[model samples]
Structure formats: C-alpha cells, structure tokens
Target: MIDPAYVSAMARYNAWQNENLYGAAASLSDEARRQDRGAFFGSIHGTFCHLLWADRMWLSRFTGTPKPSVPGSESSRMIEAWEELAAERQVTDVLIGDWAAGLSPEWLAEDLTWVSGISRRELTKPKAQLVMHFFNHQTHHRGQAHAMLTAAGVKPGDTDLMLVDLRG
Candidate 1:
C-alpha cells in the first residue's frame, strides 16, 4: 500500500516541519514553552515531547530499537529540558530518515504484530498501514503544536508539505 519513496518524502517533511517548529519554540521563555495551554498534550513543550516519544515508540516497533521508557500518559513530559529535547529531536529525525531510506517493499508488505501498550491487547496490521499511521500521527500532533506556538506569538513557518523543497 506504500512505497519507500513515499516514506522518504514523509521523513524529510517531518524533519523540516520539526526544524521550523523547534526553531520557533527556541525563541520562547522556558516558562512560556511549558505553560499549560489547555491543549490535548497541555502545551507546546508537552506536545513536542509527546511527538518525540511517539516517534521513538513507533520506530522501536519498525526497527529493533528499544521502545521509549515513558507511557503515553506521561509522554507529554518525557523530555523536560528544552535543549536536551531539541537535540534528541534532531537525532530522532535523522534516524527516521535513515530508516525510511532503507525500507524494502518485501519488508513493508509483511504483516506486523505487537502488543498494544494503550489497549493492553495483541494487535496485528499491515506494515504499510502502520507506517502511514506513524507519519500521520506526527502531522496530527504537529498541527496542535503549531496552534499553540501561534497562540504564544511564535511563528513556525510553512507547514504545507508541498512547499517543502525535498529535491536535495
């Protein structure tokens, strides 16, 4: 249902959006970044942390990497320090890109099974579908974060995937 090219494009888009969001977030005071903004994840910092945590969790499933230590309920606070979070985000972005670059059609075509941490039940699905959800989840939460940043008077630029020049 998906191809490596599509995944690669998404990985690049994810990194680009993250760079813009994190750059805008860096301008805010720590208090402002962490303040509860009534968002689903609480605030910009909280939302970003959750995104990172979720990405790591999904990556762990896709790869053989260790899953994130924190649970979904605590994901919002997964990385408390701003600088550390930013550095980790950069590293995770690269990891996702590299992983996507190496995906094979045979691998993506196979079914994947894993226990659901949230539901506490065994779940199975096509790898392609799960891969699509992985990127989709990032975009979903990033939208929430973009709104929060805008509310804080911080401007994260050009969220449109089409506008991202991935040619390089």
Candidate 2:
C-alpha cells in the first residue's frame, strides 16, 4: 500500500516525463509520428494516443471524471489531430496532478470496483494498488514512445525519476 506523498511524487514524475516525451514527439513530423514502427501500438503517435486514452479511463474510475468516448479497442486512435491530442494531454497531466494532490489516506485504502471495458468483467481492487497501476501503465507505453522517438532521431532527454526536477 502507498501513501499520499508517494502519490504526489509519482504524479509530478508522470508530468515531468510526459513533458519530455511530448517535447520530443512534437519535433517530429506528423507522418513520422504516425509511421508504423512495429510497436505494440503501431507508432509513436498511436502509442501516445493510447496512453492518453488509458489515463483518462483510469482517472475517470478513480476520480469520477468523464471517461473517454471510445473504448480501449480504439484507444490508439483516440484523438486524430496532433494539436488536439497534445492539448488534451497537457490538460490531463494537470488534472492528474490535482487529483493526486487531493487524495486522502482513507480514500487510498478503500477498494475500487469497476467493469473492465477490455475484459468485460467486473473487478474490485485496492485503490492504492490501482493507482500504482495507473502510473505504471503510463510508463509502460511512454517507453514505447520514447523508443520510437529515438529511432526517428529525436531524444526525449532524461527519463530517470531522480532527475525529474520536482521544483518545476
């Protein structure tokens, strides 16, 4: 089980890593970003889109916010336009930080129950564990995006959590 400070730190870390990943992704042409690179999500743009969609989905379950319109099946194609996707991502990052900041120990200790869109099954689990998975899922996909960006000749810079300038 995790605590509020840990959640806040991870939230900040998520935003910092997102800034780096999106900055590098922004440098690439739309065609390059959308190009099939044999990743789990097909391309850099696709991976980013899927990550955003999943983030929103988890956030919705955790915070009672609105979920993404499309299901996980179409997550890779969530937002078609680069501008819209980027804008939504920036907004979601802030929302995530705010949500993490507001979390209470009592809330984290409770269990969350929701139906899985992908598996079509009702599931219940500890909120603390689910929150960890939320951040973990972002890292899992962002790593794919980072690799794609690098292969396309762009660097996302430092990814280590220790190097994430929390003062920002």
Candidate 3:
C-alpha cells in the first residue's frame, strides 16, 4: 500500500516550492521574467512553463489521460503568458500528489508506454521509475526556474525541506 502520509508530505512540498517560485517571480518586472538567464529554458518564466509541461506529460502516461499538445522545449514554453501558466501549473501539481497517494505497488510495477512527443515513437518504462521521475523532474526544472528568478532580482524564500512547517 502506498502510504498516505508520504503523499501528503510530497503534496505539501510541491505546494511550498511553487509558492516560493511564483512569489519570487511576482517581484520581477515582466521584462525581467522574460530575460535570458542561461538556463535550459533561458528565462524564469520559460523554465517555469516547461516544468509544468513536463509534469502534465508524465501525469498523462501515469494515469492514462490525454497528453497535452504543448511542446516541452524552452522556446515554445516561453511563448506562453506567464500568469496563466503559473496558475495551471499549481493545479496540476496538486493532482499529481493525489494520484501518488492512491497508487499501489502493482500500478507502480506496471510498465507505461506512450508515443514520444519529440520522436513520435513508442517508449515504455516501469511506472515506479516514471512516477519518481515526475517528482524529480519537477525539482530539476524548478531549480532552474529558481536560479533564473534570482537573476531577475526576485528572492524565492527558503527552499530547505527541513524548513517546511508541516503543522502550518
């Protein structure tokens, strides 16, 4: 059985991280959010949007939902309007935590396959690894987003997991 507490903790972590990210993003001028920062996505807003795209893509494969048509590259992601994408990303992260809580060992053990959005060919992998990838991928891209936000002159509050106030 998937422990509900682990899921709840992850959910809170995801929320806390994004709250800091967006809070920092908000301090920047639109021009700053859009500035090139040498990240894979090259800007705070672009990295944020790409993280959302990756989360949705992995969730689709995990839950059999339809994968979105958004291209997961840095350029296509930056073309989106920032505020709307940030809000949508929040919703998707909550859904992922909920899905993770209900997952069974069997579900995680099963292999998932989907046509690669990049290559248009079938790819399959164990679901446990993919689910882990989903969360890890979020952290990876969010770190890039965080760094870019700093370059844009916005301070994202503490990212330390130990600092999360679980009782709050």
Candidate 4:
C-alpha cells in the first residue's frame, strides 16, 4: 500500500522543483527557451509543455477534471505562450497538492480503470500504482527539462528530494 504521506510529500516536491525550474527558465529569451536542443521533447519549452499536458491528462482521469484537448503526440506544443504556460503550471501544482492532501488508504487501495489515450485501449490497475505513475511521469520529464535548462545556461538550483524544505 502506498502511503498518503509519501504522495503528499511528492506533490510538494513536484511544485518546488517546478518553481525552481520555471524561475530559472524565466531568465532566458523566448527563442532560447523554444530552441530545439535535441531533448526528447525537442526543447526546454516543449518539454515543459509536455509535462503540463501530461499532468492535466492524468489529473483528469484521477479527479474527473477536464482532460486537456491536446493529443499525446502534440503535447510538446500544448501551450506555446510562456506566460500562460507558467500560470497554468502554478494552478495545476496547487490542484495536485490539494488532491494529494485528500488521499486516503481506502482510495489508494482500490483499482482504477481508464481508457488509454495513447494506446486507445481499456486498462485497469491499482490506484496506488497509478498514483505512483503520476509523480514518476512528472519527475521523468522534469529531468529532461532540467538538462535542457542547463544547456540554455540556466541553473535550476538543487534537486535533491531530501533537501527540499517542507517545513514551510
């Protein structure tokens, strides 16, 4: 069984990391942020957009929130405007935190069945595993975005989870 505390902590960490990354990314010009740097998502901006789209997609499944209209193949350009993207990111992070705060063992222990947008197939899995995937997906893409930020000459500060100060 997945611990609610761990999910909550991860939600906080996800927000913390996004804030740091977005802050650093703010220093770069729009062209620099969007320039293709050979990352899987092509650029820092593209990767960030993909991350936001994926979050929204998963959150929709998890919370019955509206699923993002963009298809998986087009996630890289879901939000082309930097300002809008950043604002949505903040809102989504808050939503994730709030959702995590309400998580319980009962909810986590159940199974979740949903249609896969990418594969176009029905799938069922433990809700706990799906919750784990939610956070894992964020971390996986953020790492790529972090590298792209570094390549663009932006330092995203420390990324160690243990060092994330959650006391505030």
Query: Would you list the C-alpha lDDT of every candidate in the order shown?
Result: 0.94, 0.92, 0.74, 0.92
lDDT (10s digit) by residue, model 3, range 23-86: 8888777888878888877778777777777777777877866666756654336337777877
State which candidate, 1 or 3, has the greater lDDT: 1
Q: Which candidate leads in TM-score?
A: 1
**After superposing candidate 1, which stretches have Cα over 4 Å from the reference?**
none
C-alpha TM-scores of all predictions: 0.97, 0.97, 0.85, 0.97
Model 2 regions lying over 4 Å from their true place: none
Q: For model 2, name the residue pairs that clash.
A: none
* Model 3 lDDT, residue 120, Cα: 75
Per-residue accuracy of model 1 over 98-135 as CA lDDT, tens digit each: 99999999989999999999899999999999999999
| 150 Cα displacement, candidate 3 (Å) | 1.8
10 residues in a row with least lDDT, candidate 3: 1-10
Task: Give the range of the ten consecutive residues with the poorest summed lDDT in model 2.
Answer: 159-168
lDDT of 1: 0.94
Off by over 4 Å in 4: none
**70-153: candidate 2 lDDT, tens digit per residue:** 878899999999999999999999999999889999999999999998779999999999999999999999889999999999
Residue pairs in candidate 3 whose N, alpha carbon or C atoms collide under 3 angstroms: none
Model 3's lDDT to the true fold? 0.74
Point out the higher-scoring one by TM-score: 1 or 2. Answer: 1
